[model samples]
Target chain A: MNKIFETPLYAYSRSPDQESEVAVRHKIVIVGAGPIGLAAAIDLAQNDIPVVVLDDNDKVSSGSRAICFAKRPLEILDRLGCGDAMVDKGVEWDLGKVFFKEREIYQFNFLAETGSKRPAFINLQQYYFEEYLVARVRELQAEGKAIEIRGGNKVSAIGVHDDHVVLEIDTSEGPYNIETDWLIACDGANSTTRQMMGMDFGGRVFEDHFLVADVIMEADFPTERWFWFDPPFNRGQSALLHKQPDNVWRIDFQLGWDIDREEELKPENIDKHLRAMLGAEVEYELEWSSIYTFQCRRMEQFHKGRVIFAGDAAHQVSPFGARGANSGIQDTDNLIWKLKLVLEGSAPESLLDSYDYERIHGADENIVNSTRSTDFITPNSEMSRVLRDAVLDLAEEHDFARPLVNSGRLSVPCTYDDSPLNTADGLDGPEISRPGSTCPDAPFGDGFLLNELGDKFVLLTIDADAPELVEEDGIAVTRLEISAKDDTSGAIRRRYLGNEPTAVYLIRPDQHVAARRPNYNENLMRAAIRRATGKE
Target chain B: MSDLILTTNIDHADDFYAALLGAHEGLSKADSDALNARLVLILANHIGDNDILSKAIDAAKSSG
Candidate 1:
């Protein structure tokens, strides 16, 4: 078994705030040192914003909870300076095979195209993911970035004000008080911060339970996702198997609604199921086992006054699509830049409302996809089962039925369509890179397009004339010029330019497209900058 | 105008109905339901157009 979780990477330490005469105030306080909170702290600190993260626990997550890291989050982590470590340590695979009744129905390759830097998905233990984020936080701290993570500091109470929020944190020594201009809740699904605020997290709750067992084993199974429906071993239920790093395999078994949880989670019972699935000859040791029932829910609004909610604190989705932490990372990616702008007074506080609007959009997309996948996997009604089984049966021989099979749709980046921050698109560019879509990465110069854009509002002009710098309403927009002739693979042209010879795109600080045109206009570009920053 | 032809498009309608019924001749209720589900999926794929398929579903519901 891996010993990383047994050690405290962020062991509790006494801070000056605990011994202060009065409550100390900070620019921003993030509650929870999980993936989202740490990523938010790193992003804000990289932007020169002082942020503090508080959590009750001192170690990384105990089990390999969330195992799949999608490409978009990997890109976001790259911006946060920890992507290389994750990808290097993670098991990368794009192929997924679906099985029904001991026969392979169909297979899919998630990354069918080329020129992107990251793979479609990587399977790394969630503990390793958190450890990398914490390591990045340490590096930023060493570089004099204003980021502090206080372990064993739990927020027991919260008070919301019009201007700032006050938190009562309980430490090992005693309870202390602190104030923050902004409060970000990166706490998990059962968020104490959210409970203190009395916010509503409403959505559908799936009635089925899933057992996840992380086993340390030496198996020759290829590094691909394998999902089975109605297999002979686990007769009626579904099963999922994925390869994580360090010779660890994560297996999930769908146990029906009315089973004895404690009895089923027994080591003997789990061993029996594993022996049946892996055949009697296989050898393995159980590293961690958990039985989880999930709900696809979110708060009505992510931003409530001075207090903002993010990650599992704001929304919870079924684990089928791997949306939980992936979308949480995206939540912070959509939030920190806006919070930074609000703090710097470059944009109005209402600009943060767009965060509520956009991440809710992302949360809804995740909820819908996950709910559908859950219904397909664990059909509630007899007719639903009949149709689901029909799809599976036909999928064995028919190509059209393959798409109907939904083991899990997998996580993909959300496009903020109809976003209030997006300016009207003027160019007939590729629909995938239109206004309100995440910028597709392409080979640019020596690196990728996303690397070139970095964390800034960029005017990406391809064979188009645009000034190097454009400042509108105190927001600086830099230019990244690329000629179509220089793109050797033509990926840039296909992804960004479409059929247009020259195109200009206004990309946001979060690397989402804000506006685009075939030719750059000074007045229009300035208005776009204003609209993108919520000055409109 | 809806793309789904609600009018009498099948020339041998009676024969087609006979064949549809003939497909589920000797199956139990569960097997018949599964067969019907598969038939719906197959014919839906053959139709391919979501709009027409949706209209056909509406028509089937209203007729039922």
Candidate 2:
């Protein structure tokens, strides 16, 4: 049997929802089919949670939206089973060059270090990401994972209850209501769910407007992030240029506070800037153009009883650092495990509150970074412009000013070093791979450390005896022995075990380090497992 | 490093100069002077070398 490949965005035909099929209760319902929404749905389905996803649009979103995906989000997408496809489809970048006017002032070389599996970042059209996620969800569904996606279903109303949520969705056929045990709002920045609840989503909104033009051309531009404080093309304002998958180059021009949106988006207006940047001879087609004002804000709480918000529904940041979608994807990664545990009644609902707390910290970190980048690029006051340019000028010669040069601090996975979920590191180890941080990926015998760890609460023992962990539903324990043969170079030992031969790492299903001890004992392992699975 | 690395480092000197002045386009005389002072302070901090900054201080003041 031949399986025909379908275009994800446009091929989704709007199916009618019957009024009689309205009142059925669902385990999980996710709103929005963007990268984050589909990711949430796919993750839940992978965890054996039956989910129904709704979206206002039937087709994948247009343009080179959210092209830059950081490595952490890439890892999260990998766990959801879509990382390879995205990396294969996208262009990998490990270097970025920041220019003061036409002169290149500073450059970032992420030239991969030893034991690093993924590149620093990759650029792929957001539509392709959505497409791959949808494909993965369908594959999971075929395996009886129980995930249903309803396109063209706009959630018109949301009623959050103590035990469940009732959503009034309007489809092409008509309007109907569906009750969900848990409703994950993966809706975007302008989330209808956010508005329906009238939650105060507060943050800073940048005054400057940026026009993003995805220009399709066959010309060869090296895969690297090129950012400018004041480029030769867009004078007095900042500009950015990055390569995308389909010979489409995303060029952003800062248009300041006032500009006619329609007038700026015109072909001639965009062509003038493109001609200036890439030279007049480089012929290109304008694939997509959009004008946007960057904003950094988030809800104080992402959870409201049964209705929980993830991604842009909960927070938004200026897109300079490519944190918007990347961070949103991470939100789903942080959320799904806790959500699955709560749904299965294996863990107290308070476990989900940890998602709210940790992700809010993540959002706040993103907001701080994005806001600083926005301020640096588009100086708020006269003195700000002075110091910003000074940093750029100094950055060309001095190493000290390089760190201060905030051309969208390249997205790095934030370590939840002080998370409540982590058993405080009682032993000594590298700070980077400490508890409350992501389980550092290291080359295993033939696979990676993270690949062997996730999908369950697993313990990794370095040349040590395996703790006799009792097998229980949602609380089962498995041990992985990382001996010298498993990693001949001792990369796992260097990153995870430190100098100790018998270090035990209790990793969560989300691949975050829950607790660790240099001396692995039955009592310590049992206690950590209980705390990790939300037992005690 | 000491020589005037003409503003045209990447072949857009004239355009860049125009843009630099353009940053002061709508400013008053006092504001334009303030921008120069700020640029000077910023570049000095970036240079960070007392000896080099001192040289620049003298060079910018000295007549061609």
Candidate 3:
């Protein structure tokens, strides 16, 4: 057993609010101290917003779930001060190989370009990921940042009010009531908050199950993603292998729908499957094993009045693309800044609707990709299987067929193509860095570009002049000026500037571009800032 | 003008049909279906035009 799960990091304790005569009101109350909830708490606390996180469990997740962390979320974690520890402990890899039968068909590298701060993806167990986040929470608490994570505080009931939300929490001491100005539900896919609120989560439930086994063993397999389709050991089904830290390897075997849950979960049965895949002589211990049936679904709206949903509470996708936790981290990234503005009265509450709009777009994109990957991995019909196998057969020899092969598209940041907040394109810059796109990280002087952006709105000028500070609707936008000539690697030029000699970009707090122009204009910059903050 | 050559463009239509049938002469029903699927994919790749492929699909569906 893993030692992290045995030790309680945030054990239950009595709180002053538990003994109060009246239900104490907090600024924000986040439910389920998973990756998403902890990230939201850390982000809100970093911005000086008081937040309290409630979780039913005190320890990290028992199993090594959600093993792949993409680059964008790593960058978001960097802003929250937890990226360094995670990256140091994670197994970084960008290459993935797809196999058909006994032979390799094709391989892909996610990050072929250079100058990015983080890799395309990293494999770190969810327990370590949560531990690092909890460590960051403790650091912030030490700094007197108003943040609290109460373990064993399970929210049993919720009352929605126009201005605030009231929560009934069950604790070891007793049941206590608390109120908050707002509620952010980061509770995972089986969200109790979502069920209690009676929000409808609608989507397709795939008809297949997958057995995930985390085996601790010493193996010489390279640190890369290896996916097999119809292998000898697992005939007519797909399998996946990934390396994690501490010599733990994650193996996923596609188990058909009609499987005996109890029989398959037996240790001897799991060991038999492992022996077949890893050969009889390879020594390994089954650290964790479980069967899961994934669904691609989401609520219609992320927020209803004072209660808001983020992460798995808001949406869910098949785990094939690593979109589950990565997108959940992005939810907090897109949400916390807007929440801060609303809390400070700097922006209207309606700005949060854009969170629903943009994140729904993101969720739909993930669902489509995840559904496609699932369909390819587990073909439903005879014709679908024939076509899928045909593609794999041709992919081994043809370069064009390689693109047709589907083995989890992998997680990537979604560009808000039709976001309401985006100002019309005013510059002929690179399409990849256009309005409504996350700013691509490039190597700047001594550091990366995203590191300099931090967590605030900024006017990034490249060989263009802009005011040092621009105030719009009580929101301050600072300027970060750089010259195109100083770019030694030309990554900035290729990513941000395309044949444009100078560029001025208004970047949102989440590092997404609000607007961009060839040169700065005071009225246009202010208007972009207003639109981005929902003051327009 | 459409990219898909709907009009007959094969120099020897009977020869092409014979070759297509000859490829699956000794296959079972399942193997024949698999061969047809692979052949469609190969020809689709050779054509390499989405609009043409979509039109061909419509034509095939209507014909069936």
Cα lDDT tens digits for candidate 1, A95-131: 9999888788878788545899888889999999999
Please give the fraction of native interface contacts (Cα pairs under 8 Å between A and B) kept by each candidate: 0.00, 0.00, 0.00
Q: Candidate 1, clashing residue pairs?
A: none
Candidate 1 lands at a TM-score of 0.91
Which residue pairs show collisions in model 3? Answer: none
Error of 3 at B9 (Å): 22
lDDT of 3: 0.90
Q: Top DockQ: which candidate number?
A: 2
RMSD of every prediction: 6.9, 6.3, 7.0
Q: Candidate 2's error at A102, in angstroms?
A: 2.9
Q: How many collisions per candidate?
A: 0, 2, 0
Worst lDDT run of 10 residues, candidate 2 chain B, spans B6-15
Compare candidates 1 and 2 on DockQ and give the better one: 2
Tens digit per residue, CA lDDT, model 3, A1-536 = 54897789999999999989999999999998999999999999999999999999999999899999999999999999999999999999878999999887778787545898988888999999999999999999999999999999999999999999999999888899999999999999999999999999999999998999999999999988999999988999999999999999999999899999999999988888889889999899888999999899999999999999999899999998899999999999999999999988999999999999999999998998887778778877665676678668756755545655678878999999879899999999899999989999999999899999999999999999888999987899999999988899899999988999999999999999999999999988888999999877
lDDT of 1 at A97: 92
